[model samples]
Target: MQDQPLNAADFDAIESTLLKYGDDHSVLNPSELDGYFTALVSSPEQVDIAEWFPGIWGGQNPAWETPDEAKQFIELSVRHINTLARQLAEDSAAFAPRFEQTEHLGHDVTLAEEWCFGYLRGVAVANWTPLPAIQATLLQAISDCAEQDNFELPQDLDVVAHQQRVAAIAPAVRALHDYWLSQR
Candidate 1:
């Protein structure tokens, strides 16, 4: 439950297990999965995890070889995700949201694009609404990310520039969280 309790090996283990169990049917990739949990717990309103867990499961039939494995997976995932949410909202300078596994966003836009989708899903399912202008603008930026597949980028912003834009999403998420919590 500590910040970044899962090292690379731990992450690999979890991801591989989930994938083996058909969790990839989930639209939220790993980074967005992190964002989803973070958004839920960061919300000003109380969120019932029990109610939301099924939605997070995303209708993926359990493919774990053993039922116990499925149970343990859910328990571990929930614990880690709750820890992530708390750490992100605390805004410790040492901690950043784990939107991607590597230091860089990626050579392509897909990770951020998936991340935006996941984050937006969290916001939507949590029913966080009527966002203030700044947060709304940030959501708009994320929306642009969501459109990465269909929308054409200007020729000037090459892959490097696109990656930089994706990397910039970390701060935008922080700002959105700050904006929402300020109402308290």
Candidate 2:
């Protein structure tokens, strides 16, 4: 099951389940989880499931309502991880980070903070070494978005600037993935 890509129903189930549990736990939401998995898949060194699985619930396993529920969650998560790896390997252009969408100043914008944070979390879990200067610059782009305060935006930030910064993330991600692939 981990080798198979999740269908729409499976994806929806994973998202809904995370939301259901997120109320009382620190579990990653769908978009954040997607980013987290992306980082793991793109890392030059592979991370073991045991090391990163606990990150889904912020370092603790949830007391699932049933064994089957836990099984399903694990299965879906593994499948998603595999799917990310396959996408990045076969068609990097098809890769898209999951982001929350909302209107800011009457302009549609993507909220990448959580997703970026999740990616950073995965980076930490992977214990990556110092990247080359160019790769480091690409990573800095992601770090900037992740470091934004949850409630406060920079005073000078305009909608267009924000969109431009968000737009850079995908290309940066693709480049970073390529860099890591070359390293491997």
Candidate 3:
């Protein structure tokens, strides 16, 4: 809500850069980064960039492959996501979490899971507080969602149900935010 507004153009280049270099090294996509940022800073506790960056960039293949521009992307993304957290906390109707995926998938598994994983990693690095029951449950749900089990989808599994589960990220983020705030 300051001089810079959270928008796509600021991060659009990162995706293109990832396409050029590849996103395999990166644990999170642009969209997940945004969600993760909100999850971290939305809390009352201040999350240091030093603490969170390693979790975000760790395990990335071609470890040093990230260009300067990519680093800038994270900086800009933090700013944008901070703004997003403010909006969400204020119950702004215009707040919509951004996703890096261009096309929709029949089963968008990674969308919420990666974002949650990023959030989990951030929380791990901060280690400032313990999670309440709801937060713990959501984290478990996301972990389940992220699993890449080599098995067929249940024939009767409802697509709507799965989508609903994935769609819970925003609310879950809000809950975590409130939890941390209350602790503070």
Number of the top lDDT candidate:
2
- Candidate 2 segments exceeding 4 Å error: 1-4, 23-25, 150-157
Per lDDT, what order, best first? 2, 1, 3
Best by TM-score: 2
Q: TM-score rank, highest first?
A: 2, 1, 3
Least accurate stretch of 10 residues (summed lDDT) in model 1? 101-110
Error of 2 at 69 (Å): 0.6
Give the distance in Å from residue 157's predicted Cα in candidate 2 to where it truly belongs.
Answer: 4.4
Per-residue lDDT tens digits of candidate 2, residues 60-86?
A: 777889999989988999999999999
- In model 2, residue pairs whose N, Cα or C atoms come closer than 3 Å (at least 3 residues apart or on different chains), thus clashing, are none
Q: On residues 1-184, what C-alpha lDDT tens digit does candidate 3 reach at each position?
A: 2436756676676555545545554543666566566667755577776666655555343344557765665667667656776776677455555632322335543245555555665566567465668788866665565562313455555667666776775666666667777777
Candidate 3 stretches with Cα past 4 Å from truth are 1-3, 17-25, 59-71, 92-95, 99-110, 148-157
Note the residue pairs that clash in candidate 1.
none
TM-score of each candidate structure, all chains considered together? 0.75, 0.89, 0.69
CA lDDT, every model vs. true structure: 0.63, 0.84, 0.59
As for model 1, its CA RMSD to the true structure in angstroms is 4.1
RMSD of each: 4.1, 2.3, 4.4
Evaluate residue 86 in candidate 1 and report its C-alpha lDDT on the 0 to 100 scale: 68
Residue 39 of model 1 has an lDDT of 69
